[model samples]
Target: MGRAWILCKKMFSLTLVFNALLTIACCVGILAGFYWYYSGWNPFAPYLVNGNLLWFAIAAAAINIFPSALLGRKLHTGRFLFHHYFYGFLVMASAVIYVVLFTSVPLTTIFLVNNTSPEVNVGRFFLLGGLTLLLDDLPDVSKRIESGLNHIKAGANRMRKVIVAAQVVTGAFSLYIFAAVCAAMLTIPEWVTPANLILVFTVLITGVTAFIFVKRKAWNNLIVNGEENSH
Candidate 1:
């Protein structure tokens, strides 16, 4: 059981790191695309920009929802809570803000701008990427948070509740966004651009895989270590 837990931890860590790298790549690609657009020299800009690189970054950040929750459950540590729940909240909150202030708003409104602009989206991309890297690189902070939370009465239970609540809310919001995007695609088939399809399918696959992995691992852990230590 202990070994199994370790294996899960390692896999989770690797996944987080990979996400961080992917986020960085997406950010770089967006920057490059912008440069190419302005300077008109790079051949790759069309591919990167048309690919909806920013959306991919958002999807990458959003996909972390699953692994973050899994790590929170497995570690039951303060660091994981901060990294997964708190930071996760920030990411989703930003998405909500983007939708409300930009995407969902009418172009005639005061807030009107290119919602798809790389300049507009890059900020969130960097924020998400930076946070993921911070989570990966800063173990001491996470451990300290974990220790602090442990010192509080019923901290573990409270933290668990918070994590669960965040996950539920985030999941619902993501679904809502996905549905909205699909509706827009249907309304204007041209909106079903390559990037939109990629984002939808990527999120679908990532969500399903995360669900299966977390459920199977929980079941296996229960069998290996029994209910008492499984938590």
Candidate 2:
């Protein structure tokens, strides 16, 4: 038990270090890509629309990065509660940013379509992502906050299930959110396009596949439970 705790401690530190590195890399890479794509435009232009879109994309990217980052830490430390709180923050931040962008960015630009009707504004993306993360992490967090039980593995598994479900649900709902945003900008609202729908499905599949690896890992330790004295 002591050794397991030690390993968990190490895992936590390593995960944090890894996430810090990846976050920096992703942020720099994404910003560079944006700059390259919009090189012709004056980045400082006072237009809130484009600027907001850029911000939204960046914020969303950060939100997406949080799980991997937290997982990296949890994989090393086996401490579930700490990372759960971090994930909750990530979801909350992403939700707020998505809502802001929903209002600021025109839907026509997102879909490259024309519409005569006003966009049907439904800022559900924020709620979806936030609620999913919350649903996934709350139990673990509550357990940790309320008690000091070693529920890391069980919590991890629960999160995996919730996240997998979220991935599946988000695949469908995100399109609606995107379509609504685009329709709001005079583009006719449509069902989620095939391309975006495919992307979401692909993500769901990947997450499901990845869960197997993590699932096994949560129990890969050599120590036998209830037999700590023998060691």
Poorly placed runs, candidate 1 (over 4 Å): 1-114, 149-180, 193-202, 217-231
Once fitted onto the true fold, the runs of candidate 2 whose alpha carbons sit more than 4 angstroms away are 1-70, 75-124, 128-196, 207-231
CA displacement after TM-score superposition, residue 230 of candidate 1 (Å): 21
Clashes of 1: 1
What RMSD does each model have against the real structure?
13.2, 15.5
- Across 132-197, the per-residue lDDT of candidate 2 in tens digits comes to 444334435554532432354346445655544443444333333334334433342353453334
Candidate 1 backbone collisions, by pair: 78-146
Q: Tell me each candidate's TM-score.
A: 0.38, 0.26
- Model 1, range 127-202, lDDT digits (tens) per residue? 4544554454333346565445335323434454444444344444434444555666777777676546644554
lDDT accuracy of residue 45 in candidate 2: 31
Per TM-score, the best of the predicted structures is: 1
lDDT scores of the candidates, listed in order: 0.44, 0.38
